[model samples]
Target: MKECVLLVFLALCSAKPLFRPSYMTLKNMMLKDMEDEGDGDGDVDNSLFPTREPINSFFPFDLSPTCPFGCQCYSRVVHCSDLGLSSVPSNIPLDTRMVDLQNNKIKEIKENDFKGLTSLYALILNNNKLTKIHPKAFQTTKKLRRLYLSHNQLNEIPLNLPKSLAELRIHDNKVKKIQKETFKGMNALHVLEMSANPLDNNGIEPGAFEGLTVFHVRIAEAKLTSIPKELPSTLLELHLDYNKISNVELEDFKRYKDLQRLGLGNNRITDIENGSLANIPRIREIHLEHNKLKKIPSGLQELKYLQIIFLHSNSITKVGVNDFCPTVPKMKKSLYSAISLFQNPMKYWEIQPATFRCVLSRLSVQLGNFRK
Candidate 1:
């Protein structure tokens, strides 16, 4: 009886950790590891680095999203720019809103790269050597709004763009022709920039921008000799500077009746047909500097909203009094805030004071000698 009692005492001593003395079960506490930045000591006592919580080991929940390799994530924004990555990294968070991948060497975007990113909005991939993008790369990204593909080696615009895209910048590429279905369902797109391409007059097909309601369009520094008349009529601003345009015809801006700002500077424009400015009654600012015009464009006085005009660095030799101001001096909605005509061959003294009667102030006009 003494030997059996001693054996029972040893068993009870070994089983003390399984239960309390009152026959109650004890819950075990859990500790999670923390990430380090390689510095040994962070604080004075290093106690604030990681804390031990009293969370039970039974319940588990992954609170934070997994960040991709070599990328920084905060507030649902992933910044992977300038990382010299050749391809898209794996395991991007599903709740990512913006992914900045600019200044990398990524050549191609695969189909399933952005498969599960449902909440992605903006994707910046500028300054890369991208040449191709799989048609279904952005298929799963339904809520994507902005996409930047500038400074790439793309031969043409990528296909299968999302319908919710609002902004697209594909400038400085080798695109020469744009088909009619390039922006077929992009009705939400309002801003489009495709400058420094090899596009010309016949490169853009008819109805190329038919389905789009873009408000701003820029195709500067290209091979355009004449204005593209097939652009959307709802344009508010149009920029086509640094091109090879030689003249402006009457029908060049007939469709752009709602245009507010027009940029045609740094071109070879020698003349603008009479009544061409009547097409845009809402015109507020016009840029025609560095051209070859001999005189100011006609029908400027009829523009009720005309406020600024840049005609510097041209071959203009004269400035008429009725060029910008009306003869009747009627009530106008907007007056000229700035009229730049410097670097022209015309003499400032030759221009009459009545030429600037509708200007805002004496400091509104800019005049200088053309030192050829």
Candidate 2:
């Protein structure tokens, strides 16, 4: 009987462990981990979030159309323009700096469309179906600088533009022609690009830009047969690319003393005389790519300040002595002068027939000129 009592005592001692406080506490903690309570960390990682926040939302300004669904909202300036919107957003935030509404289906702009935007600087409405601009389209804001309306169905330039406007790009529109007084009063205008319009066929009369003060004018790729003689004297950069100009005289550019760059690429120019560019002394860069030419012009050697010259894809077969090295005689004065003859087949031999002639000609030059 005593032995039986001792066995019962031993059994009770072993079972006591199951009900102990430490063992129960450990078992409960293990069950919590097994139940997947986020690895016991306080923060939850959200890698599955669908969309990210906007960049302009942190700006101090109040710009906006708030963003559309699946987009984040921003403040400095909203870009809800390319959404094919028919009209401007109503609840756009104030103090906007710039608004881009390009490539949309917007048809009209009411007077109050941009009512509260006091700090708006640039407004881009290119490639839209805007047929009309309200008279007070930009009555409120005076700080607006640039306005772009290219490739639109507008019949005329906006008369609501501010005089303080510096740059205006309204090319490729339904406008027929620019009258002498169309942009005559814009004293601050500097750059104007009005190419690819069909207005020249109707007759671009003289003094079209009568009193305009633009410096850079681009009227290339408009199927022009003759250069516009009414160009401003202050015109600095002229791009007449892809035109039908086969006859370019010397005096055509004589009036533009301040002309810096001239782009006549992709034209049907077959001939260039010796003094073709003597008038424009300030010509620095000339791009005559894809033109018909047999040899380099003579007076190009006189352009003392010419820096870069591009003559790619021409019909020149051979290059003799002083073809490029002596073309610009004053190239030695400048530190750097780059001439690109890419896309041309130049067969320069290691030991050419005229190699000795070039060396002898250099030695025969006037000794006084070399010393001076």
Candidate 3:
């Protein structure tokens, strides 16, 4: 028995980590999403969302029209990405549906840049050096839908964006303040990603998200110290991970009734006010990993549709049977799919199986090996 135990211990020490330690796995989630969407080699980015949703809205063809000098033109798409250009190429075909201008040195977008692209559906200007955009730059492209302006040097959201826009990725910029009516009349917008900016709570003006029905919004890696209350009430997914948020208050999520997926991981969150999550009765996934939480937040059992709860890499020391599931098991609407409690300080042996009675199975529950 001693010989077998020694062999097992030796085998364990030589084994590598089962999962990537810092890859942001809310079920294999974002940050990787940003890379997949940043690739320009593909004809079209299959992933529209910076997290999960795939891009299925565009289909490029082989019909070539009036192409710019050094750009690739095919179908109704113009591919000018990854070039060392300093300005928007001229004579772009009028019927171009999508323009790929990412990874360039373009510094400004003047009024005549997109002067005649009336049929333009998408414009990608990511990974550029843009600083100024004329208020009327996108005036003629009134039919534009998807816009990728991430990884730029913009100081604020561009003015006079098309009201028909659906997905807008302006993350990884130098934006600070978001004035009111910034997204006004953008009723068709559903996804908005603005992570890696220097925005804070005070910089966001009152009613900043007014007139927006955008559902998925990611403001991760920002300087925010608390949740922005002015976000759209129709939000289904809100990812604020990697911010400086220290607390989750009751009023922070009072108006978001349809919230489903929430990402608050990698913050300074020490406490989540009781019933703060109950306001959104339909919340499904909650990413609270890598925070300073001392215990499981109160009132989780009252949530009917809660499935995934990421509480790993925290200071939790205990687990109660009724803390996650209601006393009456039938009150639960959905079975817990995943419950991550790794990297905490809790004693694994002390946690009983009854604690996860609502879970799908023991394999679905990730526990044990709580390192100090």
- Identify the candidate with maximal TM-score: 1
Total residue pair clashes for candidate 1: 0
Lowest lDDT block of 10, candidate 1: 23-32
Per-model TM-score, in order, reads 0.83, 0.67, 0.82
For residues 28-109, write the lDDT of model 3, one tens digit per residue: 4543564666645443422223233322223243333468877887656789998888999988989677899999999999
Q: What is the lDDT of candidate 1?
A: 0.87
Task: Put down candidate 1 lDDT per residue, 186-222, tens digits, no spaces.
Answer: 8999999999999998999999999679999999999
lDDT of each: 0.87, 0.65, 0.86
Query: In order, what is each prediction's RMSD in angstroms?
Result: 11.8, 14.7, 20.2
Candidate 2 lDDT by residue in tens digits, 229-345: 677888889888877766577667776788889888888776775676888878877877787766655555556566666676765555556443334434442321555554555
* Model 1 vs. true fold: TM: 0.83
Off by over 4 Å in 3: 1-65
Arranged by lDDT, best first: 1, 3, 2
Model 1, residue 15: displacement in angstroms? 32
Question: CA shift at 116, candidate 2, in angstroms?
Answer: 6.4
lDDT of 3 at 86: 97
